[model samples]
Target: MSATKASKLYILDTNVLLHDPKCLYEFKEQDVTIPMTVLEELDDIKDRKKNVAQEARYAIRSIDSILSKATNSEQITKGVRIILPGKDRDIKLGCLSIFPDHELTVRTGFLPIEHNKDNKIINCALHLQSTFPHRQVVLVTKDINMRLKALGAGLKKVEDYRTDQLVSDVELLPEGHHYLDTPFWEGVDKVESYQRDGKAYHRVARTLLPNTFLNEYIYDSTQDFAARTVAIDQESVTLLDLGYQHLMNQSAWGIHPINIQQAFAMQSLLDPDLDFTIFLGSAGSGKTLIALACALEMVIEQGRYNKIIVTRSTPPVAEDIGFLPGTEEEKMTPWMSAISDNLEAMHEQDERPQSSVKYALEKANIQFKSLNFIRGRSIQNAVVLIDESQNLTPQQLKTIITRCGKGTKMVCLGNLAQIDSNYLTPLTSGLTYIAERFKDFEGSASVHFQGVFRSRLAEFAEENL
Candidate 1:
């Protein structure tokens, strides 16, 4: 469609394209404008060795192709239209020019004053807002403070790009204690189906009935039935297992439990309507495992997507590539190893062997990308899993989510408490920002796993640490 004919005009923020290379198509059928300044700004990032730079380059090439094709087509093939803001656009910039560009930032997007690149992008957003008055200009961003700054500058209608919102926290209570007299485990002959409280429970091949106190737990093989006599406190680890298994085994699809957070992560993944899913949990808590598992099932078994794309933030604490690396893959090996390890564990141990997962890694069918490099490509018909999402800046998260293509699903998993960045805190981190911003959307949901499930020592250290 002609740029003027489209009802709404969306000015491309530099951070938007940087977050997702395919962000050009996000406003499909709408008049999407990319200020010449934004493209110029991206040129600086488009050449770096990192993934972010690579993505910027990809976006530049993709958008350039679109512009070339649109030169002949009546409607813009891509949603973006290149334009240098005219007299009206300059007026807004003139008004905001008095304040330092750092002070004038996009609300709900990244504004890393520490990073010069981010500062200019924020300025570009403000400049576009100032320049366009006639169009219903909205600053779409993932930075909360940027949004706040945009509004404080008297610019109206800043919006969070969280197309996905989270489901409300479910209120649950632990009730019932194991009864010694009623513990009728007539064992070991044949497995029988069990049903309780209107739900059918799994029938284990074997059953264990330890000595029971008034509050001890018990399950019957004959029927999937068990309950405690009183409300169990959150400190009850045994109860969480019972509760978690009951919920997880219900379906391989939707939300299956690896730990408490799996439910929340699953909710986010399944809600195709939600724009993003953010998962946070400590190490060994099954955050990555559950995310990978769910993504695998969705893509391979459920036919939800064409492939699985995995990426993670490189912790700043590590040695720089120049200082300790051999080749690019050698440098990235440490960061991607966790993902490789998880895949190995997920496969049938004896049938394929651990090396099979490594072989699969070499195959082109799956994608393993660095967070710094994901900038420019649109992810379509794929299940995108972002690990260590806590390290991403709000602007970074915004960029990543906006690149999602039609039929794509994204799952973000990270540990807020384990964040390694100097500039962020527990609540201000990107994962926290996503959880708060998108908590209300029907297609999105957030879950914080309370108990650790990896091992006894891991759980103990998490509690103590």
Candidate 2:
């Protein structure tokens, strides 16, 4: 067998390409095959009025860019040599081919051609597996059910597309804070206390907390002390002393934190120095409430920002905002009802709750925006709140984040456990991506709220269900 056939063959799936368009070039030195059914699905999706349409177009473009290099249909079927972009262009990788699965004849052990798209793709893999019995033929997809079905259908190799997964386990992700078993001071061997610009700071040895990152909160079991890492070096870490009482006392739009996690989230939100913040938690953990309250305070009360730009990833089933009636904001209102709910919760005690929410909406200059229209526009002097961020991919998050111009504070809130995207998991989520990527940046902070304070039923559901 030729060296190209000796290497493993990876059959690409439609969902994998939609999840990450650059996936065509991700497999190093391994041949890739795209079945005709996958291309048909991409073609059908490319013109749709959803976010995935853009991804579909991108995947098509990427495939065309490489396959266009081939001079003949025979080369296209056999395989076209894969080339890496930029400095690595000289290094030869694997080959990419388009399999004519539509012309494939059904054989024994092959799934019925009348089966769904997934089964057809699996049939393509099974053909390749039989054609090259000595080589490994893997089906790469983001769908768990598809993987199971592929295996059950007798495909030996099936895997999820995990090239972007940062952590194997969700629990290994950073929580933005560390809880000390004993008093923080007791564990410290040496410390230098001083005042800088009227703020107290403690310079402690880096060995005290070797795993510390910028803006990470540290608190002890006593709940008497709380400090945020302001600076870190090889020798020591500078901590800004924030009294635990002060963090709890911090209020935004008349909302007070009921737990230390909430307090940490509020502190991160209210800090003027932080330009980016992330809140990761379960549903009913007050992520949206705290973020909305703080955005209102900053935009309406403090005048730190001119407006609040609220946007989120609509569920895959409801991504076609263009199909909805009225203007963009009107179309986005349904997906952003969580913001409205939080606004009402903030003003629930007022004599006119709906009137208060309406007033706050107008006064704070809050604008509901669809994620589709966010790209390529510079958002300035605004507090951008991205809800349901866990559903977004890293590329989508980067597109929105890069739109932040001067004097913009970006807040992302999401529950990893509540991700609705079939292509994403907690580890591969954009929220998790940014949380890990920005943990060491001084201007960013992350807080994971552990409590579900919406109601007793919600708390019970969060724990048990």
* Candidate 2 off by > 4 Å: 1-6, 105-109
lDDT of 2 by residue, 184-268 (tens): 9888878899998878999999999899999999999887899999999999999999999999899888999989999999898
CA lDDT for candidate 1: 0.56
Residue-level lDDT for 206 in candidate 2 = 92
Superposition error at 130 for model 2 (Å): 0.7
Give the TM-scores of the predictions, in the order they appear.
Answer: 0.49, 0.96
Candidate 2 — worst ten consecutive residues by lDDT sum?
105-114
Candidate 1 residue 429 C-alpha distance from true site, Å: 1.3
Segments in model 1 whose C-alpha atoms lie over 4 Å from true places: 1-246, 250-264, 267-275, 317-331, 358-364
Please report the candidate that would top lDDT against the real structure: 2
Best by TM-score: 2
* Per-candidate clash tally: 36, 0
